[model samples]
Target: MTTSTTPAVKSSEDIVGQKYDRCLADLLVKAGVGFGAGIVASVVLFRRRTWPVALATGFGAGAAYADCDRAFNPARIPGVRVLEKKD
Candidate 1:
């Protein structure tokens, strides 16, 4: 009696779900940092304005989105080359 040797396969849904979770976590962390920075800048530099906080938070979210896009589509990243073997 020989034991079967087969690798477990992950479904596409699982892969997509994992990626989504990662991106969400990244967005939340980056945006939170930006918000904190904005609060400090607003208090010290902008006469306690609200726009700075909003702008900084937006920037953080945008950066996260860009990163997620690149992850989902590596070809969109600049200056990367893929070498193929000539058989």
Candidate 2:
């Protein structure tokens, strides 16, 4: 009896789609955290709350976080090179 082994191969489209999905999910999580923080801050600072202000703050925070993440974690951002230190 012989066992047949087949290797799994991923197409370019599938790989790109997966990467896109992961990036989107990461952004969503970051945005959610920012939104929650903005809401909490708004509540603490003012007796009244507004959706526009909260949303603006949330998006700003999310963008900032994404930028920082990409800058610090080069592995996450494709084509970005990380410099290594020489001993």
Candidate 3:
């Protein structure tokens, strides 16, 4: 007798949850970096103004949102082809 091995399949909810977690992490990291950069810029070039910090943070968050959108919807990505499975 021979045994057949098959990989475990993840439910849709699990996949979505994982993606959400990843997006959240990315957003945090990017925003943190942007905040730091903004701090440096404010001290070095902006006369310690507060607007740069907010603007940079917003930019980072927007970028993260765009990246998350692309991740959730692959069709939005350019130059990508979606192929159907043939069985």
Clashing pairs in 1: none
Candidates in descending lDDT order? 3, 1, 2
lDDT by residue (24-52, candidate 3, tens digit) is 99999989988998999999999999999
TM-scores for all candidates? 0.81, 0.54, 0.82
The per-residue C-alpha lDDT of model 3 at residue 17 equals: 99
Tens-place lDDT per residue, model 2, 5-84, is 89879998887677667767766777777677777767787654777456855686568567666644668797867679
lDDT of 1 by residue, 4-62 (tens): 88988999999989899989999999999999999999999999999999999999999
Best by lDDT: 3
Q: Give candidate 3's whole-model lDDT.
A: 0.94
lDDT value for candidate 1? 0.93
**Each candidate's lDDT (Cα)?**
0.93, 0.70, 0.94
The list of candidate 1 runs beyond 4 A from truth reads: 1-7, 81-87
